[model samples]
Target: METNRNSNIIKLKQNLKYRNILIDAFPLLGLIIIILFFTIITSGNLLTLNNLKIILNQMFLYLIGGLGSVYLYAQGGIDVSMASNIGFSAILGVRIMYQHVGIGIIATLLIGSSIGLLMGIIYAYAGIPVFIQGLAMDFLLKGTLYPLSGFKASIPVPDRLLKFDNKYFAWIFLLIIFIFIFFTYNFSRFGKECRSIGAGEIASIQSGIKVKKNKVLAFFISGLTCGIVAVYTLIRTGSASQSTGLGFNFNVMLSLVLGGCVLGGGNGVKVRNAVIGAVTFVVLQNGLVLCGASARAQDIVKGILFVLMIVFTSKMYERKV
Candidate 1:
């Protein structure tokens, strides 16, 4: 009886190991299937060089913003205002460019970081929930920018900035940011602290993780990335409008989820997830267009996929827990 019981336990462990492997592979599999399906439907137009370039261009901002958001999300924090903050930062940057291009870029980054730091402090020290704080900040920034831009439907970006739109520059910048984030997130104490906090705040605090300080730092890092991405947006569009960054936060959240980064945080977070998710997202959007799908149809498809992905990932995490 003892021997039989031991064998059954071993069989159960083997089954669990296989289950975990499948969960890990699902995102990549989904990406592959999407690409293949779209390629066939589009008559292979999806993989043409021009379309590929367009996809890459669309992906740059999402990839960077998504990376920044990873820090906040890893600690189970949400910032609904990130898109608005980017819009405000771009407006400020464009205004400064009227004086000096170099100064404009520097000023934009500084403003973004400062605002992010302030929000972090409020959430961490003032006992405000990050979600509520983010919502307030979003409204405040969007309102401030709306009036300052003369309520213009679109703020024009300077023509001089258009020279910087080369894909090579974007690739290099993205690579650097990815490498820096990858090392910091995987190798540093900061990353470990973030994971611990996300896993269990009470447990992390009892373990001497300095929860408040880390939370503030995570927001700061997220803000800094936002600052950089603001620059990317300015160059890409050469302008900022009232609707400039509208819906960006949702897109980033969707990308993170599609990449397998759990909203509950801990253990499953990875920089690669941001990269893969960004690519998949851009491809999905572009492919839908190439396949002649209507705007409403595209949105409906994306929405359904987003919810299903969330449900699937949530189950995977629950099983692991």
Candidate 2:
């Protein structure tokens, strides 16, 4: 009986190992399928040089936001207010640019970081649920953004500020941000702690990790990245408007999920999820547009995909148990 039980246990472990391997491969496979599907539908127009650049341009904000969000997601938390936050920051940056370009940039970063820190504080110390707090903040920021942005008017950046909008500059900036996030997330104690908290917050607390502090820091990083994204948006678009970050929050979430990042958070989360998800999301959006899908139709498709991802993620976790 002992020998038989041991054999069964070994077999179970092997089965689980194989299951996980297959599960981990899903995102890459999905990406490939999406690419092929869109390429075919668009008659190969989807991957042309000009189109590729457009996809890359569309990817920057999502990628930046997704990278910053890894920390929050790793801790099983999310800030749905990020879109409003970015918009507000960009508005401030644009307004300030009228005074001084350098200071405007500084203001944007500070505003973004400050809002993030504030959100962190409320989340950590106020004992509020992250989702609730995020929604409240989102509403508050939207309220502020509309009035400040003149309710549908666009605030154009100074001509001098537009000089920073070169494609090469953007690519170089993305590389720098990617390098920083990669190392900080993989090599630092903070990242490990965030994952630990996500895996089991009570257990993490018992293990002597400062859960509250980590939460605040994670949010701060997220905010800082939002600020960076705002700068990028401002430079590229040369303006801030009421719709500056429209649909951005959901887009970022979609990108991360598409890349296989489980919002439920766990030790299994990988940084590559952000990169892959962002690229896939942009390509998907670009392709849909090229196919002449209406905005409403695109949104409906995204909604369906989001629901499917949630179901699939839940099943994967259940199987692991």
Candidate 3:
């Protein structure tokens, strides 16, 4: 009887180990497996350097938006108007960049950060909820820019200012920033407080976490990222149009979920998850384009993936009685 019980325990341990492997591989493992299958089907044309570069370029803003939302989502708060903030700031920044490089860029970012900071202050201090604030921001920004740009107002983005989209330099610069954020989140006091607040805001406040202040700081950080991405956006397009940021609202949300972040607080909210999810999204799109998928079709596919990812990653908790 003793020998039989020991045998059963050993078998259970082996099965648990196998399950852990499967769980860890679930993220991107599907993406890799699909890529391998398609590579064989496409005769290895899917793995070219050109395709990879295209995918990386597409991933730029996805990663940016993902990392920016990390602190917000982790803290049980989110701002969907980030794209609008970008759009609103793009008009201000790109317009400034038309002449002076040094002063224009600085002024644009300061203005961009200020725009987002306004939303944060309303939500954090004025006792206004984030959802309403974000909605108001979206409407306010869209309405404000729609008439101002005058539809097809072709504003020139200078070559000197366009160096960020230089492919090589952008990669290096973003990588350095990613590394810095990773380390900060991994080994900083802010990271701990964020987790505490995420776990329970009331408890964190009771524990002296300064919940409101940190929440505002998170938005401010997100605004800083918005400023950086605004510069990149102008560079990539080389010309700003009225419709520059009309419908990017969903893209920001998609980037967050794709990064394995849950809507409510207290879940997987890592910078790496968002980066990987963005990469996967970009690569999948690049591959589809290579296979002659139309841009319209790609939009439909993106919507499908967004739904599927949300469903698969859904979380439910129950209390034991």
Q: In order, what lDDT does every prediction score? A: 0.85, 0.87, 0.71
Q: What overall lDDT, based on C-alpha atoms, would model 1 receive against the true structure? A: 0.85
Clashes of each: 1, 0, 0
TM-score of each: 0.94, 0.91, 0.85
Best by lDDT: 2
lDDT of 2: 0.87
Clashing pairs in 2: none
RMSD of each: 1.8, 2.4, 3.5
**What's the ranking of the predictions by lDDT, best on top?**
2, 1, 3
Report the candidate with higher TM-score, 1 versus 2: 1
Question: Candidate 2, which segments miss by more than 4 Å at Cα?
Answer: 1-15, 150-152, 293-300
Number of the top-ranking candidate, with TM-score as the measure: 1
Ordered list by TM-score, greatest first: 1, 2, 3
> How do the residues 207-283 of candidate 3 rate in per-residue lDDT, one tens digit apiece?
88888787887777777777776777778887666566555556666666665555666535667667767877666
Which structure is stronger by lDDT: 2 or 3?
2
lDDT of 1 at 152: 82
What would the per-residue lDDT of candidate 1 be over residues 181-298, giving only the tens digit for each residue? Answer: 8888888999888888888999999999998998888888777776887888888777887777788888888898888778987777777778878988999999998999999999
